[model samples]
Structure formats: C-alpha cells, structure tokens
Target: MKLAILPGLSLDEDELEITYILASGPGGQNVNKVATAAQLRFNAAGSPALSERIRVRVLELAGTRATRDGEIVITGRRFRSQQRNREDVIERLAELLREAAHRPAFRVATRPGRAARQRRLDGKAHRSGVKKNRKVRADD
Candidate 1:
C-alpha cells in the first residue's frame, strides 16, 4: 500500500509503522473495550524514499510530533473505528509530506531605501516635537 504523497514523491507501506491504541473518547461501550485510535510512526531520517533536503524539512515541519530519534509520530482518534482512524493518520502523514515537498521561495536581502529612512526620521522628529510641546515650559 504505497502512498502517493506529492506529484513526484511516494512512500512505501513498509516505511510506516502503524499501531492501534485505546482511544479516550465517547464511543458507547466500544470505546473502553476496543483500541480504535491509530498511531503511525515513520522514520524520516532513515527513509530512502525521501531526499536529504526533504527529509530535513519533514523533520522541521513535524515540530513536536517528531521524536529525538527522528521518528514522526502521528495519532488519529477522531473516528470510533480503527480503520477510519488509520486512514486519518495516513491522510495526515500525506499532508505533512506534501507540505515538506514544496521549497520555500528565497528571500532577497534588502536595505531600507534613503527616502524611507528619511520618512522614519521625519516621523521621529515630529513625535519628538509633539512630546516636547506637551511639557509645560518653566519660563511660562
């Protein structure tokens, strides 16, 4: 069950480790008795399918969801059924991978223009004048 994450990237099913855990939610009698939540773990660092750059980005995008061991852990407990929860986790993983696939636009370094700098200084001077005027003159 390979997952097609982005246009050119796909992840093999073997790359994912999925487990079912008991969910803490209202699901009648089945909630306490059955494990319906799905926990999906993926090794982003060790994944052969991901390029080095994408792997690093994936780890960065994962934030707290990523463990120190470079594993991405995602939990899905929205649904009462294990199948649905599993699908939900998989969907979340795909969405995350898709986000990692896109490269950010490079930011061109810029400096404040002379006119803009002059305007800022002018505003500061005007503010200083207003504040100075607000003070009662000792001579007056």
Candidate 2:
C-alpha cells in the first residue's frame, strides 16, 4: 500500500498504527462474536521518520486526535464488518496524509478588481436606500 504522507514530516502509516477492537452496543448476536471497531494509534512525537517541521505541524493538526504520550488515536465502529472498519481507518489515514502533502499557497498582495469594487459600492448604496425607505418619518 502507498503510505500516506501528511503535512507534517510524518507519514500516516509510518507513524500511525491500527488495532481491531470488539465493538460495543447493539448488534445483539453478532456484537459478541465480531471485533469490528478499528482503533488507530499514532504517536506524533516518537516517530523517527518524520521531519521536525512536519512532526510539529502534524501534532498541532492532530489536536484531540493526540494522546498525552503524543499518540493520536482515532476509532470508528459504524461498520458491521471488520473489513469495512479497516477500510474506513485506512481512508481516514489517507485523508490525513493527503492534507500533509500540500503546502498551503501563500497569499500575494492583491488589489480589488474595478468591477468588483463597483459592485460592492453599488450593493451598499442599494442597501442604504432600502433602509432609508423602511424608516418612519416623524413628520408623518
């Protein structure tokens, strides 16, 4: 599988690992028998593979996804089958990697377009006219 690399120097699969746990609630007969819930474990600090820049960024992004030990844990149990849960975990991990892959475009200074500025001024003027019309005249 192509490992997912996220914004931080950390790659999803390299830093993150998953374990299948028994799912809780409902499912009656099937609940006890199947271990379908997926638990993903990722450590933001401990990884040797991540670049210093990316690791810190990934940690910030992980937020609540992170643990005190710098581990980011995510769990999913919506699927009844273990395979689907695994796929979900993989998809989520991939998403994180996809996020990491791109450097956000920096904003270059720009001036408003003449047409857009004109439209904005026109809209504000129109709004003022509408409000003016709605006002009650004390003389009336």
Candidate 3:
C-alpha cells in the first residue's frame, strides 16, 4: 500500500518500519502491561520515492525527530490502544511529509519606508526630550 503524503509525494508501505513499546501516562494497570506506544521509522534519505529536493526538505523539517543517518522516528502514545497509537504515528509521519512537500514562501527584502523611518526618528527624539526634561535643572 502506498500512502499519499501530498500531491507530489507518495510513500510506499514497505519503506516504513513500525515498532511498539510500553506506553507511559494514564491507562492504569493496562498501561504497564500493554505495549501501546507506536514508533514509526522511515529512512527519508535512502528512499527511492523521494526526490533530492524533497529529501533534503524532509530532513530539515523533521528537526529533532530525525537521526544522523537520515531516519525519521515518530512516536505516538496519546491513545491507550496500540491500533490508535499506530494510526497516530503514521498520521504524524504523513503530516511531516506534507509539510516538507510545500515550498517555503520567499521573503521579500524591503527597507523601511521614508515615512516609517521618519516616524521612528521622531519618536526617539520625543523620548530623548522627555528624558532631558526629567533631569534636575542646575538653577533649581
């Protein structure tokens, strides 16, 4: 099965490796015994499905979740059940991939307008005058 992460990016089910571990938090006695936490690992760099640009972007967007070896590790423990946790992890991975699929908006470089600069300078001058007026006069 292939997961459609975005319009341009789709991930194969074979590329993902899933593991389950004991979850911590509110589930009472069942939490300690059941391995409900789901961890999904995907090697973004080695994937044949990703382009070089998307791979780099995915690695960048993955942040702390990504390993040095280019594997993205997503953990889900919000749900008490293993099935829900597994779905959560997969959804999280898809979200991350979706974020990486989009190109960042280019920031337009702009200098302050003449009026803005003037207003800033005027405010500074007004503040300076106010501070100057607060000082004790030598005559007083």
Candidate 4:
C-alpha cells in the first residue's frame, strides 16, 4: 500500500515501521491483555521518496516528534482497537507529509500607500487634538 502525500509523491508502505504496544487509560481488563496502541516510525531523512527540500521541511515540522536519528515517531492510542489505532497513525503521518509537501508563496514586502500613510497621520493628529482638548486650562 502506498500512502499518497501529494500529486506525484507517494510513500511505500514498507517505509513505515509499525509496532503495537499496550495502550494507557481506561480499558478495564483489555488494557493489560492486549496491545491496542500503534506506534509508527518513519525515517523521513533517509527516505528516497522525499526530495532534499521536503525532507528538511518534514523534519522541521515534525519538531519534538522526530528523534535525533531523523526518525519520526508517532503513537496512536485514540481507538481501543489496534487496527483503528494503526489507521490513525497512518492518517497522522500522511497529514504531516501533506503539510511538508506544500510550499508557501513568497511574501512580497509592501509599504503603505500614500493615502494610507496620510490617513494614519491624520488619525494620529486627531488623537493628539483630543488629548490636547482634555488638558485643564489655567482660566478654567
């Protein structure tokens, strides 16, 4: 199974390493008996599916979730069933990859227009006049 990240980018299922562990929280007796939590590990840095730029972005976006060795570790315990948790982890990973795949448009620096600048100055002047009017006169 391939995880489609973007239009032309897809990650192989073999690239993902999934392991089931004991889920924490309110599961009564089933919690101790079954390993319902899914832990997924992906080597984002070493993956051939990702380009150098995207790899860097993915690692940066992963933040604390990424280990020192460039592996992204995601744990899913939201569902009681192991299959559901596995799906959840895969979905989360896909979301992260999708985010990394998108490149933000370059922001062009712009200065305020002459009219805008004038309006700002006018507002400041009006505020100054309001403050001036509030002053107690010696005659009063």
lDDT score, candidate 3: 0.93
Worst 10 residues of 4 by lDDT: 1-10
Highest lDDT, which number?
Answer: 4
Candidate 1 positional error at 121, Å: 1.5
Tell me the RMSD of model 1 versus the true structure.
Answer: 2.3
Off by over 4 Å in 2: 1-15, 109-140
Angstrom error of the Cα, residue 134, model 3: value is 6.2
TM-score for all models, in order of appearance: 0.81, 0.65, 0.79, 0.93
Clashes of each: 0, 4, 0, 0
Candidates' RMSD to native? 2.3, 4.5, 2.5, 1.2
lDDT of 1 by residue, 12-120 (tens): 9999999999998879889989999999999998999999989999999999999999999999999999999999999999999989989889999999999999999
| Of candidates 4 and 1, the better by TM-score | 4
lDDT of 4: 0.96
- Score candidate 1 by TM-score against the native: 0.81
In model 4, the runs with Cα more than 4 Å from the true position are: none
Q: What are the Cα lDDT values of the candidates?
A: 0.95, 0.74, 0.93, 0.96
Overall local distance difference test of candidate 1: 0.95
The pairs that clash in candidate 2 are: 6-100, 7-100, 8-54, 9-54
Number of the top-ranking candidate, with TM-score as the measure = 4
What lDDT does candidate 3 reach at residue 134?
100
lDDT of 3 by residue, 33-55 (tens): 98999999999989998888889
Tens digit of lDDT per residue, candidate 4, span 1-140?
88887899999999999999999987889999999999999999799999998899999999999999999999999998999999999999999999998999999999999999999999999999999999999998
Query: Candidate 1 — worst ten consecutive residues by lDDT sum?
Result: 1-10
